[model samples]
Target: MEKQVNAKPGTKQKKRIKMNMLIDNFQLATLTLPTIILLGIFAYWPMFGIILAFKDFKVPKGIIGSPWVDPIYKNFQFFFESQDAWRVTRNTLGLNLLFIVISTVAGVIFALIMFEVKKAKYVKIYQTASIIPSFLSWVVVGYMVYSLLAPQGGLLNKIIIGLGGEGIQWYTQPQYWPLILLISNVWHGVGIGSIIYYAALMGVDTELFEAAQMDGANKLRRVFHVSLPQLVPIITIMTLLAIGGIFRADFGLFYNVTRNQGALYSTTDVIDTYVYRALMNQGNIGMSSAVGLFQSLVCFVVLLTSNFIVTKVEPENALF
Candidate 1:
């Protein structure tokens, strides 16, 4: 009799727990529904088209019915064995590495300076001014760059002429593009890039800085010891993410900004622009798809390798 009564109570508790779990699941699903739909629509669904890389990919045969490459890697072989491969690879890695270093350093500096500013109005003004370039489209930026670099009447050439120097043909010269691209990329990206560091900076415990001040740490000392250390994790994560894109390039920056000028291809032509040019010339969907797939695979490998290194060095900061 006593056991029978306890069984009823235990059964009721189980039912209540089950009901609560169902309700919690419903709430979670409701919150996640939109995100799941978007990922399906934009991310996962597009992956179905990856088969195009191996296939000839004609419109009549469609993605599924298209015939695979003879060697199953013909497209990749063509790309790697081509004369432009070394040049494009070199340009892509060189520019991106340079960009990553310069932009990260500049963004951190800008964020640190901004975080130290006490006046809200001044902070707002500085932020607004810095971010203006990021808002401008690449097309507009191309025109602006042209105005500054044009051989006939560019501001830079004009300045050179006034200074008793020869007017440099910037677009036609590959030697100058590394510096030009670096400056242009940094100028365009620093504003937006700094925002992430700034947000991370805001999250740092104010008490830590106060303690550092009490310990007789000057502003520069505090920056190096306190702010910079706190920023290391976020910076590491961002840099790791950037490493994933080392094989890629900003199409707008390399293409539109350079006016797709063949002369600048020596320094400016990257994997993206090279693939684009190849696709346009050959009109081969499979080749273009192969390039995209190659980029993705390389990016994935880079991300995994970088994350693995981070995990070994700083498990807490590693992005798994």
Candidate 2:
């Protein structure tokens, strides 16, 4: 410029601060860039396939070129009209609700027990052992369950025989599946679930516990007042997230664990397993997609409604 304009000292300082802030933000963005790209490629890209739910998908025709169903809702009608619809829906909702309640309670109790250990090394050992099961593939877990429930040579049957009781045909009986599934689900999941609650417990204020001790509170009393109360927010958050997946079932658990036996289908058949069977047996992609989309919609609505209620009752704990 022809004329030199003098800049204020405060203006230079503000500019420098803005520049520094921008640099910090840039560094953070660079660190997160890989994650963003991966999510875009895997998660967002597959979203385009949602169109298949409406289309009468044909192998010869690509997704975009496929003809839309005649009634548009025809694919959805196929599922709703099916005889197994009510059974699968009920099993999905019931089993998931049961799993949520039991797992949450078990996790909390385990965490509390771990918290009382006092020694860091022992706590680490316990945590590592518990978490190991969560990493095992469902296929491996299925085989383990099979070994325990096999008709003749199964571990449980051997024990029953030892006790002079008849060996039960575990797989063929639907009546016993509900309890068996529940126990297996809790065992496999409780470890990882407890870790979450335990981490939250670690963040509790020590001063509160100290105050409780000073006020003549016993261990149980301190747990109820000091620890459980501290966990309410995190519990609320986790429960809300769980609610979002209420319409979905763990496909592996219901499928692999039950060995996909027709007899067990009465008690264990869920939307996910039903869709998988339909796809494998009938090769009806459109109907399967419709059920999946319906599940997603139901889950979304439930999550929003639950969040709304929580917001009204306890604004701070609401996820949104």
Candidate 3:
């Protein structure tokens, strides 16, 4: 057998080896072709439209035919100089930060709590209940919220009148919207976020928990020492990803839930809603494109900075 193996391969062996490699490559290419085509059509193709941001766009002139801004900064200048800039920026960042914090903490807590439930049936039921809201469109959620907050016939107002108190106009009041939006966002988002943490928790090595128990660690101690530490990487990755969209608000949530009420713009207006309003009211595609480009640039910078910080603090957890 050794002598036979040492013998030089004939032309058939060489051709078969080459044929197998060719077939493997063909299979890989075939599997990936659709994805490549999709990316080329949707992602890479639309990226060329980014040039519209720097052009003084006119529908008659088309994208390529449109004249460039006298100063490339003109579109950006219009946005930054507008009175809506500060308010929208503040609303977007503040609400997003609040949502991130609440979601992260609530998600982790829920996951840890779920981890302790011995019955898989109860865990599944709880998870399903929590996650169902995530599947609901913001339009549906908006109506649900409206029913609970409508001034004349809302559930809250009914309860208030029953208690000898005046019914609150929840939508008209800007002061109450921060709380409302926070609650709305958390309620809609926490389930999906918790599912992420739950998945991370599932991957924790049982041996770590066993070792902790061997050291006289109780359940809470084991979770704190073993479970939490194991989860830091996943948590860091999720936070970094969230940071990329810090400047972008959920349009459906902000627009639909607020009913686009002018009175609520002070609290609910965000970069996304502002862009939509600009496009609708002014029909300035360039301005809208500029806003979009600005959002993309800011998100990119923030994501990079956040990733850098994570790398410095905890290299292992950093998403490269």
Model 3 residue 203 CA deviation (Å) reads: 1.5
Runs in model 1 lying further than 4 Å from the true structure: 1-22, 25-31
lDDT of 1: 0.91
TM-score of 3: 0.90
Tell me model 2's lDDT, rounded to 2 decimals: 0.93
Best by lDDT: 2
Clash count, candidate 3? 0
Shift of residue 293 alpha carbon in model 2, Å: 0.6
Local error of candidate 1 at 87, Å?
Answer: 1.1
RMSD of each: 3.6, 4.3, 4.8
Report the Cα lDDT for residue 99, model 1.
95
List, residue by residue over 1-320, the lDDT tens digit for candidate 1. Answer: 25554444478888999888989799887899899999999999999988888887788878887788899998778888999999998898889999999999999999999999999899899999999999988888889999999999999999999999999888789998889889989999899999999999999999999999999999999999999999999999999989988888999998888999999898889999999988899887787888889888888998899999999999988888
Candidate 1 C-alpha error for residue 239, in Å: 1.1
> lDDT by residue for model 3 over 134-210, one digit each (tens)?
99999999999999999989999999999999999988898998888888888898888998889888888888888
* Candidate 1 TM-score to native: 0.91
Q: State the weakest 10-residue window (summed lDDT) of model 3.
A: 1-10
The global Cα lDDT (0 to 1) of model 3 is: 0.91
Badly placed stretches (over 4 Å) of model 2 are: 1-22
